[model samples]
Target chain A: MDFSGLINDFGPLTVSGLAQGAIIALFALGYTLVYGVLRLINFAHSEVFLMGTYACLFVWGLFGLDQNSAAPSVGLMLLYLVIGLVGAIIASGATALAVELVAYRPLRRRNAPPLAFLITAIGASLFISELTGVLTHRNQKGVPPVIQAKPLFTIGDTTVTNLQLLIIVLALVMMFLLDRFINGSRLGRGIRAVAQNPDSAALMGVNKSRVIGLVFLLGGLMAGVAAVMYNLKIGVTRYDAGFLLGIDAFAAAVLGGIGNLRGALLGGLLLGVLQAYAAGLFGSQWLHAASFVLLVVILLFRPTGLLGESLGRARA
Target chain B: MSVSEKATFRSSGGVRGWFGRQPVWVRGVVVAVALVLAFLLPYAGDIPLLGPQIVTEGIDWPSALFNMSYYVLLALGLNVVVGYAGLLDLGYVGFFAVGAYGTALLTSPDSVLYADTGWKWLMAVPVALALTMVAGLILGWPTLRLRGDYLAIVTLGFAEIIRIFATSTTTLRGDRGFASIPHPPGEWGGKPIFGVTDAVPYFWLGLVVIILVILGVRNLDRSRVGRSWLAIREDEEAAEIMGVRTIKYKLWAFAIGAFIGGLGGVLFAGEQGFINSQTFVLQFSILVLAGVVMGGSGNMAGAILGGALISYIPDRLRGISLGDTDLYEYRFALFGAVIIIIMVLRPQGLIPSRRRAMELKDREKEVAPQ
Candidate 1:
């Protein structure tokens, strides 16, 4: 292992890792939320994020924003960013809802086996991803570089970029708002009730299905935000962009303790930093494997994850 | 077990009922006929059922048949895990890689081991099977404690890890691949047994292995081990309460599944005379799982039919022109849609087993009161 490479690059690794983790944390919230309510993995959440990337890109395309196009002036860039975010959020939320209604709810109604739900989810995931693949011809779409990386500061051979600061800050704000929304709203209370005890929640007039739908909507919105962040940060998006990253995000969710909101944030940041360090010590190719091995080890020791599951609890 | 069971038995009143009503000897004759037709299926392109109007022009029938047989083997193996044992294994391809890499390492001249041992491909077959089974045990031992979807994701992780090992490591050569893998040796009379000139021999060999697997699997399915698997699938808690040794039986299913999947990989290595990470993508595992679910899990015939069609549908459309692009480009998307449609329409599968049919019927009965 390249110990010196890792030790020497610790500052850059932390900065970059947390920035990367922010996207994963946002992405993982969708998986965590749906899992909290439905207790289903919602395999197509990755595709929900996948759609968001394209939706934003397609919106940008409408404004004659090709990859080679020079960045617009400040006002236009802000307008472009706003337009993209709105488009991405709507597209992602709609897709998630459609998946719930079309692919999942029927199985839920029939009380299909868990395996059936997983298989159907796999089908939906593949169908949507492959359709995107066909449309994009399986090519990586170079992001139009709306957000350029400007160096914020340098400390002892480490440089923190503006992009990193923006990603981390944006992610934290979204997470805080979501936490407050879930913990402080009537609908959120309904979600907790349904998650805690579906039968009792129904008896108490919680509108369990609507709560489930609301949970999916919230998850989708977060994924859309993640997709935009990912595009800006990575400078590339593809049909399978959500796929590889989704694996990382899923690992983070599981690491934080699946079905727990704050846990996903903790898991995402820890996993991202750990991965960056591992990549420095080992190689970049080992990054994906490292995350999984970490997941396996964590699962072995504490399957509930670093933070305990809290979707359903007797919290005052 | 009792007269009530026999008296209340509802024979599905359909073509299946008529077919099921036939005497054992007659059914045996029908099976033999079907087998003969299956053996001759590779030549359907040459038969010209409706003359040259049927353009079997682009597809090499033998290769397509080989692909189908390969999938059938995978389906049969996966059926043991997902179908019988009720384990959701999303990373079954990991075992497949273990087998292929095992065989390749032993027989391929490009591999480091080839310089030292230089074993024949056939010699590696048993070693490959054993290696995959051990790998299966290792993976199952830990992850089996988790719940269903959790188990699935862990398995999926295992598959990706295997692929990464094949991709990133210097050992496996990544995408460059191991080439000139020594083919299985031997000849019959004057001709080579499964020669490299045509894939027909490989298909025939695959057929032989598939038949042996079906026979072995059927016997096991009817035995005590199979009963344990069924019990575990039906209700794990109930099975555990009933002294079923759920974990042990689940491990057995997993190991056996690995063995069969590894065997398929070995055959693939032998036929292709090459091995690569690209050949063992995670999608293939999902496709195998899809076959089991779509074909009718818990039924051997259903698995066989499902596996064949899963491969065949794509193969058949390989060269069919669609405006500008070939149909092959759209096959996976179409296949995905097909799987979703099938699961939505008939979650029980096209040819569901008697037990599963009964379960579904019982569920419907419960849904609609008398």
Candidate 2:
């Protein structure tokens, strides 16, 4: 229906989509990593991301930076960004650990049925989100203008903004670091072992509990970064913001092969771009519906996903 | 007998055992009496202890009971899928929406398909039920083969799609919804019995539907189909290897569950006389699910109690206050905390199925190695 409009705005839409996709890729790593090792969906992980978004806002608020404030100078902006990122990372990591300890560990010890774990995860998720909702009066909090979206470059009809470049570059750097950490590090081997087979990993003298905790922490850190980038781009955060985005990120993880790291990256980018295109074609109201249709279709046709669930395989 | 066996025997030796020992005629009479008492529950506000405790302060007592009826219906239907069949359907509300929408389209004057006079509520019921069952098959056919979590996400996606479609489509009228969805046809001495002012008739109607659903579900739980569901839930691969047609039973579970859930929706629309996309939020599905899990997922009595409590607690909290804030404001948060606590303390739920309880005990035994 809007072919000509889509063609006209193709460059700009794709650029924006890529920026969103980069953030989604970062957000998706949390789901992929946890699902890889625990084989649980970690429903509370959305609340973990949500906590990061609010934590960063709280930190920025401490520095007297309200939504109406002007962007700071280069040095101060960098300092503020660092402070926000640290606050978010710490908050998200602690929340993830707490969720695991409170909602999951007891069930694990009890050897509770899989349904129990899912239900508890949902409970934990609801508890945090509803608590936040009550505290915030369900209002959307606006982010301070820390870094203004100045055009850094222009190509065709697209003008790449500084914020978008920062988000994309930062996400890539984090992904590269995570990839190396999992592939080249000793701890990464323990993660792979546990993912392949938890019992075998425990038999091989791996501290299964420690590894699981570490996995959660790492995922939380990634979600934290994604949270900050999301604030910078979207400029507002709400208590239930994570609910919809979390679905998209989870779909991305499953789309790329749920247990595979690299696959998450691929899936997130593809999904983001596809969503942008779909929005262009079908109007913005059908944006989420389009993504869901794609998810169902892919699951039906290729349940193993594009990368074939490599985290549980020997190669990963 | 082993220690666990003694405990199980003791647990089953109380009211349930007494009821089991009665003759079939005695059981039938007891059920009839209970049903009669339930029909009189609209006047429960006149009672001393039961009325003051259970009746909602903000909303009328009949309305709350009506709410409980539909919620109980949803829980029982969900119990079939999640409890008996071991399928985690996060999108059970989708069927409810379908049923309501189906009825709305057939009966509401605002609907494009409506004729000179729209269909009666009774006429729309069977169509709504059939549509929901078909919807279930559509959703389940491709996704049931997935692992549990995957199936969950897919079902979640399915509901989200339904909601998004409802919200975005102009034909469904989005949030404006359809109005004048005809109430169930009835007259009592020159007055409409199912009028908007009194929700008691709706409650009775819901009660009747629930009884029918209970009888149907109970029979299914005793048949070969129910046995296959049990086998699948306990172990899918073993059941498949044992020559149980796992897929067929799972689909059957889904279809039946959808039928019951759709029945809830049809009754809901008829009572409300209006419906919109807002009525079918994902949270509604989750609330029903929480009710089932908390009540006793695999037990009919448990599902009924759980469903009633979930609706009742929120309504009961209405107009009550804690210190500075209204208790209703914190109801969902409190419910969430309660869910976490219950799962931690009693993962088998408040009134677990006997077999499920035994299974949990067996699993604990393996873990503890006493």
Q: Which tens-of-lDDT digit does each residue in A1-316 have in candidate 1? A: 9999999999999999999999999999999999888888888899999999999998999988989998777788889888989989999999999888877887767766555676687788888999899988999999897877889899889999978998999999999999888889888888889888887888888887788889999999999999888888888898888878988898899889888999999999999899999899889989988888888888888877899688887263
Model 1 CA deviation exceeding 4 Å by range:
A72-75, A154-157, A314-316, B1-10, B46-57, B364-370
lDDT of 2 by residue, B16-74 (tens): 76776677999999989998999999998899877787679988889999999999999
Model 2 chain A: lowest-lDDT 10 consecutive positions? A307-316
TM-score of chain B of each: 0.93, 0.94
TM-score of chain A of each: 0.97, 0.98
Q: Which candidate gets the maximum TM-score versus the true structure?
A: 2
**Scoring each candidate complex against the real one, what DockQ results?**
0.53, 0.61
Instruction: Put down candidate 1 lDDT per residue, B104-210, tens digits, no spaces.
Output: 88888888888886788889899989999998998989987776766777898999999999998878988988998878788889876867778887888899899
Every candidate's lDDT = 0.86, 0.89
